[model samples]
Target: MKTLLNVLLRLIETARILGLNYRDLKNAEDLLMHNEFGLCFDTIITQMYEYEIEIDDELYESISKIGDIMNLKPESYTFMKELIRDESNIPKPLKDELTRIITSLIE
Candidate 1:
């Protein structure tokens, strides 16, 4: 239940970042039935590529804790490492923010 709640929160946050309103999730069940679960993280990565935004500490900690508890596979870990390290076009402040977040995860 806790995991589900976290995933749902991430889904809602993703929609919000995509400039979506509540109505966008009105048909969520059907909509999500056809989408990849990993797309949520991919969306975050893509958004980071375009522009950085604050990720609340709680949310970041939730993600990091989940990853740590799960002992995520090497491939998944590599994927995350790649996503966070992709600072190609981000502004300095956002880049620094990402660096901090990634660094936290590293430790």
Candidate 2:
């Protein structure tokens, strides 16, 4: 998931643009630990969609290039297609439940 690192770096820019809280930092770590590039990319995309923000094309391109160089499996691409067909609906696993879970744990 080397490409995921590229995506994460770009996500920092996205966070700045959106002025999000520090939770994004924790989310980034969780994504890395999980090694779930597709799932987490979908989550990021879905969150941007919900917030009516534009996706960063350059970051996306960087991720795609890395995936190609590393010959990543088709899993992420396949999921992306499904998200497109479903009109960017956030899948169940990518829901915001973690934020609540983490919040509760911290509290």
**Highest TM-score among the candidates is held by which one?**
2
Q: What residue pairs are clashing in model 2? A: none
Off by over 4 Å in 1: 1-11, 14-31, 65-107
Worst 10 residues of 2 by lDDT: 77-86
Query: Against the hidden true structure, what lDDT does model 2 obtain?
Result: 0.53
Model 2 vs. true fold: TM: 0.42
Point to the candidate with the largest lDDT. Answer: 2
Q: In candidate 2, what are the lDDT values of residues 1-107, reduced to their tens digit? A: 46557666576556547544456545755775687655455555445444444334454565455456546665553333332323356544345667778889999
lDDT (tens digit, per residue) of candidate 1 on 1-107: 35644574565565476444444444443344445334444444344334433344354455555445445444442333333333345645666879999999999
lDDT of 2 at 74: 53
